[model samples]
Target chain A: MQQENSVSKLKYFPVTAFSVVMGLSGLAILLYRAYHLGWLPLWAYLAAAFTALVVFAMFVFIYGLKAIWYFEEVKKEYNHKVKVNFFSAISISFLLVSVAFYGYLPFVSAGLWYAGVIAHLLLTFHTVVFWIRSEFEVHDINPAWFIPVVGNLIIPVVGVDLAPTWVNIYFFITGMFFWITLFAIVLYRLVFHKQLAEKFIPTMFIFIAPPAVIFISYFRMFLNVDVFSMSMLSLALFFLGLLVFLVKDFFRIRFYLSWWAYTFPVSALGIAMMIAYQATGFSVFKYIAVFVLVLTAAIVAAVMAFTVKNVVLGKICVMED
Target chain B: MKNVTVVVVYIFGLITGILATGFLINISAETVLLKEMASPYDFEKTVEVLAKRINSTKNWHVTAVIDQAAEVKGHGEGDIGKLKIVQYCSGKYAYEVLADDNRKKISVMMPKTFSVYEKNDGRVYIAVMNGSFVGKIFKGETYEILEKVSLEVEALLNFINFKFSLF
Candidate 1:
């Protein structure tokens, strides 16, 4: 009976936690830079904290590697169209590390960039191949698909100066086109197909990522202000405004690794705001940057704390529906 | 046959005109923004030379040297050639700038960063951000300090380039 009860209590950790670990770690590194720039003196501690989370993320990645026995469930989740896109969050985390450390620790950042670039490309290419080779119901389409696509947009962030201009342009164009294609499909699904599953609802915030990420990418790659960059910023702000009302339901959901779905998009928005401030020298953008930095930092920290608590209480890393 | 020959000449002329225009625009833009140096030394040697100069200077120290190529390899992949960022800061200048409440915000742009990279053609280049142009964004003492720092930083890079060029 004791052994049976132990087995019963074991909850299977979802692969989605890969994203949570990455998202929070990425956010922490962003905050460290923000604090450093703002002269807040919290940069050092945050850097240490981020490193710790990176170590933990490595372990989680290993666990995911061994979870191949769960292939049946993985395939089911993968074919679901929306759910599989969350896998891209793991890619985002590595890319985030690359950007954060690009200045302070070049070698580490470069390594992470290479890792992020290869992983994101494979993930994205395979996803596209899947889309071409398989058929999915129209209703299954949602914003989560944007996750895999955003990886391309993210390359230009650090890769702008590091990679050749042509390579960066390739990623920028790929990301831009796919973002448009998915935006149309996702909008149609929202209006006509069906409401998204409750667990996947928070991913609505993902719509905010492409514009924000692309804006940052364009500015970094070209190192100049242009019409396209301005448009990206404008669209990003508009979508972010729309998400304000949409995310009301997100806060009501219970804590799950899916909560990490909210982290990177917000962090990207914050980074975009900073880039805008850098370009325009506007005080308003500066204030907005600080606001986003604090808000995402709080969200990531709270989620991380809760995650640890759940793990200790045997709520994570076991089997559950 | 006569008409086809004329059309081909016109097409070639149009392409030549476009290329000439592009070349002129690139030259003008280069003059307007950025003070760059071409290094005969490889990317790593170029960074090492500059880092040594900064270290030897008074009131300035090399805080960090970021080897971007090594970083990519650390992630279980091959290196990305030679891209690096060398960060340096003057303690005296930083203290002077941050001592005031008004100028504290510019601290975010601190540590005076410059990038060294080898492009696809295998030519090495060092690019420095114009601190003075950035300083123009601010007003008062902070702006003055940024302007001063910008010139000093520019001079440092040029000095490094000159010193390396000699060797």
Candidate 2:
């Protein structure tokens, strides 16, 4: 029996299959363009870019089918096989670029690098459409038609020299919105859902890892992550509230661990923002505000760490088991 | 042991992602290195040249320096973006990219900087390449000066720093 939220699996049979094929082809051309690019030619880059956008359309289809977001077929392909393939594809692409970069093939390597950027953007879009809770979520309105809506974005940027630049910045902003919103919803689910923070908290260390990597990556790109960090800080605020709400239930050791899970990402972001504010220069109000927030976060994390010693690991956890 | 194994996998993924980013960043950083300029010019000077040449500042804010940006320290052998930020502007060029319709792509170029910076010793520097800008300008029938803008800017740098020796 399918869960109430799990919609039918076969809602997007044709659209999905077509999208997967186009996506595979686009990625194949992009990969070949990394080395091959003989018969395909310069226009092939445009073709791959176009095809990649076509792939983004299919995501709209998948999102349209909300409940059965993870059909057996979709799961089999994307969750396991495609994830490994794309991850390796990016990894190998990076390795090749590294070799060529040191060897001084900067021109060719730069082109491939930008193309890889495009691929990564596609992956980010896919993750948002499939995983996040938003208007684009599969279940709500079913915007499979929105595929072409997004594809329309490529018409302006494609075949132009500025295509990559224009498309990349555009996608970066949109992707940030999606990722931020998703992060918020996940936090919401954790707070209200109760059991979620428990299960995910055990893996909270994993939660801290990816966003840290993403923040670091965005930083390296010369992106002013003040906005992203601000969003992260907002999440930290909610986590703090949740921690405070649960403080009265001092006996629940596992719930307390959940608070720490939230703190990890929140504190990481608060620290990032503090560093940013320092870089921005000294506005007393801004500095005081950032200082207070960071100091509060530090206090929270310090308390959480101490709890592991004072209560959870030391006493509470010891008592529970 | 299972917990340790999981943590190990998590750490492994983090390292891999970072390595991937570093590898890709190298290509963009290096591209700025090899692509040479035809003359010695600073982006500010280029802005001046462009203003004089084009006779229009109405749509272009040429040679704008980006201030208060954090220096991208410890990047690598040739990471220039971390050092300096030089912004350029041309609404006409942006109009061209957007293809005279659907202004959404306009945000891509966003009247941003080409970003050039000189080291304290003035030996090393970094900047961005406008492959499309050049490609667009030169490809057309006019042997347009805009075609060689980034190259000229590089040349301008060579002049100022006496490194590439555009003179």
Candidate 3:
């Protein structure tokens, strides 16, 4: 009876939990760049990469068990509107970890990159088809809708070297097209519709990731600093500033697993700044890079601590209202 | 009433003067503190030649050559052109500066650096701090030592024909 009761809780293991891996892997890749710039010690990158890998494995193992034991429950999550979007987080975790290991382990990195690319492409297809077939109320559309789109943008960060140029470009163009379309829809939803729920408010930070990832991927492809790349970077910075301007609203909300949404986007912005500094050789960019790095570190640490606290208190992994 | 107007004018002038000074510093800081010259050889050859010359010089040793472009690429930021920083130090000069407690603070500038980079114009250039100009500001034994170091640095760089600087 005791074993059965404990096993029954597996049904509540939310698919959204994969987002923890996304956040950790993003930080690991950012620290890896900082390590190369001589801004951080090698141990910093190693620790972050190791932690991300371990946590990702743990989440995948647990979530896999949940799928096997509670197939119907897992199916319910996949069929849900908002919950389904986070499934792409699994593929994104693979791509980000692939980037973090690209320097030390090329073979492993290439394998993971292939898996991530194929998996993300499939997920993108499923998501688009789902959106077309289903009717979503305007209120149902939120920043979480951008997750699959953001995953596409992340492909070329490592895919440029591992895959053919045309393949990477294909992913880049697809991601850019969807990003613009979704940006307009999301903006319309925010301004014209009812406000997002409190739990979903942190997803607003998702606004920072697409353009920042686009900037990095664009720079990696062409290796140039042109007007288009700069505009993407500036747009990302503008959103970051706008979020900071409305920080009080964020502070008022209690912690939810969605808080993990704040981590990867901020990390992406910081990584973009580091790339900007390298491309332009501007001292101002370098200073901004360091500043964003420090801010990202603090945000990730705080979110992780809160996550651990909630897990210990049995506040997480329970049935939602 | 006249006295108050005079005070307001003086305050306005002082603020304007401070702003102008700050603007000037922002514009001139790089040129005043550093010097850049074109390198005849390509990026890799320039770094190799400088490292070989420094190692061959008396009492000087090449400490490290940092390939920043490779480093950036290795970490997945992609290439940012050819940028390398070469660090060299002389034990004799280091000891001369560090033997005194007061002069030890100058050790920050000890392992002198030379930045060899390729600009967008596809020309390779080498840049180093203007040690002599900086030394003159100190105006003491430090100035004498740095002045000598500057002349030796110029001599080591004589392989390139003197011409116009892109800086």
Candidate 4:
């Protein structure tokens, strides 16, 4: 009876839990890029990558159990207004893990890339259709909405090698179009509507991911630092700056699962800065890259600590109101 | 009013000085610390010739030939044309640099690199750190050794007829 009661808690496992994998995988990719820049040792990258893989496996196992035991709960989350957006985190996690491992295991990376691309595309289609069919208040809009769009942008990062150029371009264009459309809507909502609830505040960082990921994908495809790529990078930096300016608000918020939202976007920006430094050979970008990478590492460490604390306190994996 | 004018001028002058100094450092750092030259051979042949030359030299051995383009592609960063970094080291030079405990930090520059890459244009080029210039920065025994190393490395690339320029 005790074991069965404990196991029943699986029903409370939120789909947003997948964001933890996205955060860890993003940090893994950032560390990998830092290794190439000669700023960090190879072991650092390997450690982060290994940890991400382990965490990803754990999440998949637990979530799989949740899906099996509580299919109706999973369906409820799927139909949820904001929770539905995080399902794409599952796909983004796969793509990021594929990128994190691309340097060491090309074959395995290719398989993961294919799986990630296909799954993300299906999620994007589902999310978009659901958006069109459903009615949502302006207050329902949040930065999490960018999750599916950003996943599209990530396709070309690893997809540049796994798929044809046209296929990469297809995802890139779709991501870019939706990112802009959502940005306008999200911004309007933020300015005109009430502030986001404390639980969702950390997701303001997602504003940084789309442009940063777009910059990396664009640079990977063209291998040049032209106006368009620079613009994307600058926009990412601007969002990062805006978040830093609002650091007081972020500091006051209590820990929530959405805190994982702060991790990947910052890591994506760090990777983008490293790529900018590589493409342009500018020391300024190198300095910014180091700064952002250190910040990303710190953020991931803090979130992990908080997550562990919450799990031990029995605050996590509990039913939500 | 006169004091305020003076303060404004001082602030403006400081800003201008900082900007000018930054511009100068940026330009000088690139030119003073590196050398670039066009390679008569194609991209693959250029790396092959450079590796062979380094191997043939006395007391020098090619440590590694890193296919940077392949590495970048595998990392999925993007294609950077055909770029190869030919890393070579000399046991004698390594000993000389490391002989002094104080100068051990210079080992970071060891296993010296020669980057041979194809640009957007249909030409192959070789770029390496200007050892002579770097040696001059740490004048004395280190200078003499690095200057010799620089000359010897330049001699290894004699097959390339083009004049080396700090681009």
TM-score of chain B of each: 0.70, 0.39, 0.79, 0.80
Look at candidate 2 and tell me the lDDT of residue B51: 39
Give the best candidate by TM-score: 4
lDDT of 1 at A80: 53
Please state the CAPRI-style docking class of candidate 2. Answer: incorrect
C-alpha local distance difference test of each model: 0.70, 0.38, 0.82, 0.83
All candidates: TM-score of chain A: 0.87, 0.33, 0.98, 0.98
lDDT of 4 at A179: 96
10 residues in a row with least lDDT, candidate 2 chain A:
A152-161
lDDT of 2 at A177: 50
**Candidate 1, TM-score vs. the true structure?**
0.64
Writing each residue's lDDT as its tens digit, candidate 1 over B1-167 gives: 25576578768956875665455434434322454557757877888888987888788899999987889899999867888999999998999899988778878877888789998998988887645434545655665466457545644654332322212
Report candidate 4's fraction of native contacts: 0.00
Tens digit per residue, CA lDDT, model 4, B105-148: 99999889999999999999899885644664664567556656
Candidate 2, residues A115-200, lDDT tens digits: the string is 54555456545544543333332222121222222222222122122233454456435534544554555556545554532323
Per residue, candidate 2 scores C-alpha lDDT tens digits across B4-91 of 7657876895687667656655544433333323224544454345335333334555555543234343433344432345566666
State how far residue A249 of model 3 sits from its true place (Å).
Answer: 1.0
- After superposition, candidate 4 runs with Cα above 4 Å error: B1-167
Better of 1 and 3 by DockQ: 1
Candidate 1: C-alpha RMSD to true structure equals: 17.8
